[model samples]
Target: MATSSICRRRSLSPRRHLTTSPASFILLPLFSKKRTMWCYQNDRCKDNFKKSFRLLKGCASERLSALVVVLLLAIVSYTLYEVQYKTGIEIVPFLPIDDSGFETYNEKLLNDVVTSKAAQNQLPRGSLMCWVMTTSIYHKTRVNAVNSTWLPRCDSSHILTNSPRFLDDQIPYHTVFNSLPESYYKLFWKTRLALLYVYQNVSSEFDWYFKADDDTYVIVDNLRKYLARFDPEKPYFIGYRLKRRMPNNGYNAGGSGYAMSRAAMRIFAEKLFHDKSLCPYHEWEDYAIARCLASMNIYPLDSRDELGRQRFLPWRPEQHFHADLTPSFLMDPIQFWGPSIFHENLVSMHHLKPDEMRLIDGLLYGVSQGIWKPQKAPNSSTSLVNSTEASPMEDTIQPPTVSF
Candidate 1:
């Protein structure tokens, strides 16, 4: 048993010897060196990778910042360019030359008076002529004549026509004319007043009613011919438009040569009677007229050449229409008075001198086919009709008389 025990111990001792030997220890040391080298290399590589990632992140941030800045600047620059493109051009104003008060015989009143007297003198056979005067009054005789023969005379007594209650409070600059309460109102009143007169009285007159200002010349034959062109069944307003810059909401600051239409009269009357509140006071006459028509869905036709201008004449043989007429004294010396000058057939003319009646009458009779020479002035021997007082003709010459 001792021998068997000794053999077992020997076996265990050999195993132990193998485990504790210097050669084995040296091999273990070599394995430890290899592991340390691998660990060191791994640590260095990890550090380098972390450094590279940090660099890449910084570069991306900088690039993004620069791109954002460029975009912001571009957006700001584009907004300023559009603001400077809208406020450059403007419109002109219409300022009448003769805006004086009438102390003596208002030509407008005289015309009405004479028309009434002539109508009465000729009794059921004479034609009645009506005239409209802006910024002036007429004689009593003329007023009577207008009442008796011309139908109605419309005058704005410098009274301002106010906007409706709801509109007045809502509109901007409503109280701007407090000092001259009616000043702003007068601008629109003259035109509207005339329109009202026509609406109430002259819807159906002898044959036709001519609309013109004191400073205009009306060629009766030419007007007759022009009137003939329009079918009374489908009446249209006729006039010359003052070419102005568009997109302007303000007044059309110029003369509207003249407009005539049976439909215009009735339509305007209906509109005014029905929706008087819709009519706003405007300083521009033409614009007001346009507004009145627009309310009724009636627009002007593009017939511009019917009226004559200082630069161009009408194409028709008998010069029947003209605008912007000035007195000979106010005109340039180089200008010439042609056959179309105010005469017997003159529907209207502007700026005639008080003493020029003789000259005007002579011209009228002289141009007659047999009365006198076309160039000859009339003789004083002819019976002269003076409409100075409140004669029956005076009533006829009141405001609203049709003049052309």
Candidate 2:
């Protein structure tokens, strides 16, 4: 039995050896890895790789968020700097060109008014003939104002300009020169040309030649009353006198209005045509006229009220009434009308702008006809107390010192 068992054991041992050999080879690596702790190490390496990748991604997202916030702040700061202290551009109004074909007239409109007045015979023609030194811009409005209000009272009326339009019959465009004067300096030539025209055309037609700017408003009735005493035959030149420089022989303030008698016009015309040097060109047209008259020893007549105030207002009414002229009761129309003396006897109003000119015509007309009365006096306050109360003769006849 021992022998038989030994043979069987020996046979099984060979088979078991063959199977164990292959199994041992496979299990040998697993046993070696467990001994070295390689399984735990591999697991740790994968976990560390995943954690590193997540941290890097989180850092990149934070950096991108900070960059976006900084960009927004930079954009807001620049916008505030521009708004605080920058000067903006200025916008100006457009002035239209005032020229149409020269020597045109609104005759149909003029004839309707003139003939209607003549038919009514409400306005009797006076001996004074008025002329306005006007331009293209003032024709429709300014000239029309004179025509509707005061010009009808005069025996004859005319406008002298470079290019006459809207009233061909009344406005005589002096085509003597190439063009009309547009600037203040050019007025010297303009006045020169006007004087020549007056000399040639209408020197003998009227007793007095009244000259004024288109902006000036004249109370024709009051003017007639004022000149009733003065003879037209005498060499009379009357207006607001200005003698700003030495040898202050007064010259009429052109804007305030002036009147030259027929005798004076004749003399001026003769001297201007015959002796050109006597009436030389000047920067100011009024100054040039004064120079011409001064050469002939004819000075401007003083036109002032008995109270020594100027009848011709060279400046606006508002200028005379201010804080400087205190004791404001005199200017208060509510105080008294009789003592409200500044413009009570006012004849010619000057320095009127286009809009103001349109409104003042009716006011002046109403005042002249006793329909509207002045309630307030002007503030004739001066730096020197005595100057405000000076005599009319002294104030008007004396040399005036003015700056250009």
Candidate 3:
């Protein structure tokens, strides 16, 4: 009975909850709150660090991508430059712009010309006139050579000289102009007079006028081909252009010969000849014409070959034309007075003796008929020629100024 009472007493004594110790009950809640706060702060710091890392990674990625793009662009540009250097073809010459801010030769114009030429079978032969500048004494041989060779290629041809002669069908120019003594100094006057006479007398018959010296050898077929690209109605002057020691807008080297459109000729006749005081009378007819044309704003066209070589050659085969290059044919005693590289398409050669003219006449005729092969000269190397040098392809060429 005493034990039972003690057990009941013990059971009833702590009817108190035994879930926690006394010390835990006092400090556990506070410790739990402190741990939770520390965990929350640690989690916030981790999130902030992760966000910062992600932003830094994104910035690095963008910078790397931009760097990669710049590198690729640089590589591509270098590759193109290398390719252009390796290939000999130049799409654009060194100096593409002229002093006047116009493109000297544009790809667009070339394309247009080529496209237009695809359909035309041949340039109209009736539209051309060839004028041979000759004296009375040498007409028999030189005139005969032209007649036998290239003169027949034109629609009409005339000899311009101031000489009285017994009228022969072969030599009609004797009666063409009143007798002016055949002097070198009087050439400019004769040329002026000839231009005036032709303009007044027979301008209605032709659309294009070609002027050549007696010693000049011309490929009329090639000339016609060249002329086909331009319209006769436009004021175009085509020739071997000379910038050095020329008038304000450049002039044609007369030894190589020159061609002027009907419109250009009309301007010369109407405006240039009438004003005797416009330019001083000089011995060089070609320079005088250039000065006269410059005043009227008619500039010379650059008439180079497909290879960018001058079609009209002024120098003989033995002479040096530029500082770096000499013009010559490979064959000893050159039949053609041009660099052998351009022999196949030789336009005009200067200083052709009357006999040599006859020989070339036969050779050129044979080539035209495909019966003869044009033999290349053995040592005639065209390595030194850079069309960009001394050509209209340069930047700021010597401005054209009149020379006596």
Per-residue CA lDDT of candidate 1, range 1-404, in tens? 34344334534675332233323334445657764345346755445445434543554575688789999877754433322212211222222222222122122322231112222222221132234433213222222222232122221111111221222221111111122224432444455555554435333332333454433333444455555656544545555433332222222222323544555666666664335345433445556666566556565444322233232122221332332332321212213245543323223333333224234433443344344313333344554365333334333322333331
Put down candidate 2 lDDT per residue, 7-122, tens digits, no spaces: 35534675332223333334446557563345235655445445534544555566677789998876754343332212111122232222121122111212222112222232
Scanning candidate 2 in windows of ten residues, the lowest lDDT window is 84-93
Query: Where is model 1 more than 4 Å wrong at Cα?
Result: 1-129, 134-185, 202-208, 245-257, 273-278, 302-361, 367-370, 373-404
lDDT of each: 0.37, 0.57, 0.59
Give stretches of model 3 more than 4 Å off.
Answer: 1-125, 164-167, 174-177, 320-344, 367-404
Number of the predicted model whose lDDT against the real structure is largest: 3
lDDT ranking from best to worst? 3, 2, 1
What would you estimate as the lDDT of candidate 2? 0.57
Candidate 2: pairs in clash: 106-166, 243-400, 244-402
Report the CA-based lDDT of candidate 1 relative to the real structure.
Answer: 0.37
On the 0 to 100 scale, the lDDT of residue 66 in model 3 is 78
Clashes of each: 40, 3, 5
TM-score of 3: 0.55
Position 227, candidate 3: lDDT = 89
What is candidate 2's CA lDDT for residue 221? 74
